[model samples]
Target: MNSPVASNESLVSVENVEKVFRRGSEEIHVLRNLDLQVAQGEFLALMGPSGSGKSTLLNLIGGLDRPSRGTLRVAGEDLHDLPDRKMAEWRARHVGFVFQLYNLMPVLNAERNVELPLLLTHLNRAERRQHVAAALDVVALSHRAKHYPRTLSGGEQQRVGIARAIVTDPTLLLCDEPTGDLDRKSGDEILNLLQALNREHGKTIIMVTHDPHASARASRTVYLNKGQLSTEPVI
Candidate 1:
């Protein structure tokens, strides 16, 4: 596949990327010369069949993994060239992840959970608290700051997860099936919050989802199939 022409405004650029996993004597190709571009502050939804590499693509963009062969750049930095330590620092400063399971610490309260990411930064305790408070407020969970994951509803717990993701005010938000575990009403609410973050907070977001309804909320949607990208939906 030909690589997409990256514009100056593009925040993520993946060109001729390939990812292969080795299983002893065999090699499994997950992505094959895949190309994609995401503009700054753009909300993009990636949809595909199971094992179609949607999450793999998301992980690469988030700097959680690297492609076996290709070039990748995010926010003007060459992700493909960064060392492990540099990559970790860059990821901590620029990328935020929202998981399907919330992934909160079982013993931590909402406030403490949201403050976890800030501990890696140079900020003081007071600064971390202010950031945590603001993030909880954004999710409208300020009143539940002391609530633990087990005590909160599924929707509220997801809100806390979102607060934790945005606590650093990251340059990019990578969500993997963020609403997959919620009911319809709760899912819609989460979608609305994501839209608000994109439109108001100017956060660049890339979401992987199987639900067409969830994908509809994004600014644009793309399909992945057989390790390739297409604008048309995959059937």
Candidate 2:
């Protein structure tokens, strides 16, 4: 696969971004003047201690939250300027998120869970089924398609989550502690799957994680602290 980074095309660009949350008279500044660029097909990892705004930055990239200041562009769309409805639509079409806790609906089986993202699209039933099946195949979880979340192992459930995330073939993937809730073995399995997606499928991934081992798997690792980015080369 061609290296998107080598091509020098940015899939996500954040410049002088800040996120501030206000509660009553108090204000919490999560991210301050953060600038980052993720090239297409690059798997970038964000590392920071708790409250360092790592997850906040990921949410901004994924369009889950708007920055209080500065500009953010993902997949060529000006995320900061998009109306709520437009942002939701853009997110459905361009971004896929993998969370630490498998956010699968308890009642939905693996195949059904994978099919949820397609519900936002106009694809017909047949098309949706085809995409769901292909996503399950990508995660090698086709055999568990009929199993409910509770019946599946933690690893299997997370695989189903990955299947759901990729079913849309979104432009980029935002992962927040994707391996955080699993055991060591299961976590490694999840990381391997993420790596495969980035390497073989040309997926651009931005993952927020505290684990050094997880950061090592990404093409580049960036550090955040005190609501600011540190360009110090990763050792």
Worst 10 residues of 1 by lDDT: 1-10
Per-residue CA lDDT of model 1 for 1-235, tens digit only, reads: 1112244568898999999989999998999999998998789999999999999999999998999999998877888879999999888788889999999998999999999999999999999999999999999999999999999988898899999989998888999999999999999999999999999998889999999999999999999997899999987
All models, RMSD in angstroms:
3.9, 2.5
Predictions in order: lDDT:
0.91, 0.90
The TM-score values for the models, in the order shown, are 0.95, 0.95
lDDT of 2 by residue, 82-116 (tens): 99999999988888899999899998899999999
| Model 2 TM-score relative to the real fold | 0.95
Name the regions of candidate 1 deviating beyond 4 angstroms.
1-7
Give per-candidate clash totals.
0, 0
lDDT of 1: 0.91
